[model samples]
Target: MCGTCGCGEEGTVSIRKPGEDTGEHTHSHSHAHDHQGHAHEHSHQHKHAHSHAHEGHQQHHESSHGHEHGGNGHHHRHEREIQLEIDVMQKNNLLAERNRGYFEAKQILALNLVSSPGSGKTSLLEKTIKDFKSQKKIYIIEGDQQTMNDADRIEKAGAPVVQVNTGSGCHLDADMINKAVKILEVEDHSLLFIENVGNLVCPSLFNLGEQKRVVIVSTTEGEDKPIKYPNMFQSSDVCIINKTDLLPYLDFDLEKMKEYALRVNHQLEFIEISVKNGEGLNKWYAWLKNLSL
Candidate 1:
């Protein structure tokens, strides 16, 4: 299991291009197997002894002391769990820095787009690709737990794309991008959009070495999403408010959403767009263009 999130078991990730054989790209974990075929995980089992003593002398205590001793063990276990999470994050961050250096050397403008499921992320990408393909060379890395649906759509949209099916993984890690780059071979001085798994919580914790992180929120969802998922808002550089065309028929408050997002991330830049009718898309395109400058 992932030490950071306790997510998918190892060996559950797969990366492939559209129309490729499904069985060719599974990522496997290296684990030893016993005679019974049980996977043996190498882990350190530490037994911690918590002794409550006064001045190095053993204290003879009753039920109250027993409760205190048990509580100490629980707190100690919690600390170990937190430390394990930190170690996992640090390792991922190191890999992310390596990916960042690669992108810098190649002059690749990589953007990681994250949002909840059905938040119009894919629609925004389709619109962006169709409208801006003439001006900028674009490529895509689509992330999902299963299916090549988004990658197929992006390929049809006129860009070379790769699909990363992370089986039970909740977020795309730096190693996945490093592998996808080899297959996609994104061109220099081009934009690479990584459509992360449709998740708000776990994706916020994993950095795929993108130059910018964009969070999409739709009018159909709660306006208080920023406060509910503050880490996502704080980590993202841009907030794209999609489905504005449905605002008149819905009870969504646009200004309040912006206010809440700004409260979480004062540095966040907002662009309101509706992919269905092409409203405010020019502003989104303009933002993309300015990134190259």
Candidate 2:
């Protein structure tokens, strides 16, 4: 299971391209599955401690202070759990730094786009890919819990794409991005967009070595989403308010959403866009162009 979200299990994650053999997929459980190994090691140590305890069992029966050690044991277990979480995050950060270094050396403009489901993330990508493909060499790493539907759409949009179906994984980790980049053979001096799984929570915790993290929230979702999921907004570098075309039909407050987002992340750059009608897309394209410059 993922230590951060506890959504994925051993052998539950897989990375593959579209139309590839489903039987030939990568089993990636390196994140939280390492806890199982740690547990085994602890168990082995416990057996030795058990033997020692058995040797001292007679002394405990004769002593009146045997219960005093119980509190210490509970404290030690709590510390171990805290340490385990630290270990998981530390390991992820180390890999993320390595991926960041590689991107820097290659001058690859990698952007991690994150959002909740049905936030028009894929649609924004499709529009961006179609509009910018002619000027820049673009590549995509599409992430989802299951299915290659987004990947297929990206492939048709005219960019080299790799689909990572994370089975039960809630978010894409640095290790997954490292592996996907190798498979995609991403070119240097090009655009690499990692469309993270449609999740607001766990995806914000894992850094995929992207140069910028863009969070997309639609107007249809409540204006209070920024405060509700502050971590996602706080960690994001850019906030894309997508699906602006539907504003007239719904009871959505555009200014209130921006106000809430600013409260969470004052540095977050906002781009209002409606992929359906090409509203504010030039600004979006301009932002992407400025990144490459």
Candidate 3:
């Protein structure tokens, strides 16, 4: 569920390559769920609580599932929400550490690319794969609510790609990647690009055990975006200021955008690139190269 918009169902993650044999590589988690009486999730779009009715509570059971005050069993909703968040994140963090260890043992570089919709993440990836596919093996795990459109784009760019259809979910968690990695049969000493669901808030709260988190933002969206979505920026290791090729026709100020982002995260590294026309992308390629060193 998106912490910002509460827009996900308590469900499983599905992973498959577009046009691949279902018998060979098909995985789904339809039965997975939390056991906490009434579990709620937060999405990037909104905050809505999802509840499930449970038995064995000492309080009087209301038909409407509302909490009525009782002698010794009434608990505050706010406290419940806090506890839910802690439980969700704690489980995710443990799995994320496992993922980190797995990648470390294989000498794989996993990078999580997070951003809002239409941030040009796919284009940047296509360009990266086209250039470096020969130099190193690159695997892509594309996350979207539905459809394999982005996965298709990455595949045509000549890279190994898997699509994770999150159904109503707004972000991908570490466990989902664990399943994808098994199907991907990823190679060692390679790059694994996890293009997380197009979200700025919910994805920030879920870590996938990636070595670095790259937040992509375009100039057309204006510089205030970083300030508006500070949580995403603060957690990210680097910020990619994309669409520099359109800077001449627009009123976007590059310096101010970085300033606003830096206000939230003082240590974030910035990369200015025009993935469309190949401007200022050497730093990006160079950065990736240095990661292996």
Q: Estimate each model's TM-score.
A: 0.79, 0.80, 0.77
**Winning candidate number (lDDT):** 2
**Backbone collision count in every prediction?**
0, 0, 14
| Candidate with better TM-score, 1 vs 2 | 2
Candidate 2, residue 164: CA error in Å? Answer: 1.0
- Relative to the true structure, candidate 3 reaches a TM of 0.77
lDDT of all the models against the reference?
Answer: 0.82, 0.84, 0.83
Candidate 2 lDDT, 19-130, residue by residue in tens: 7866236654456457778976885676566544444355444543444544444212211123344555776788899999999998899999999999998888898988
Q: Per-residue lDDT for 118 in model 2?
A: 94
Error of 1 at 75 (Å): 31
Q: Model 3: residues >4 Å from true position, as ranges?
A: 1-12, 21-88
TM-score winner: 2
Residue 282, model 3, lDDT: 92
Q: Candidate 3's residue-wise lDDT over 118-237, tens digit each?
A: 999999999999987777799999999888899999999999899998767788888888888898999999999999999898899999999999999998897898899999999999
Order candidates by lDDT, high to low: 2, 3, 1
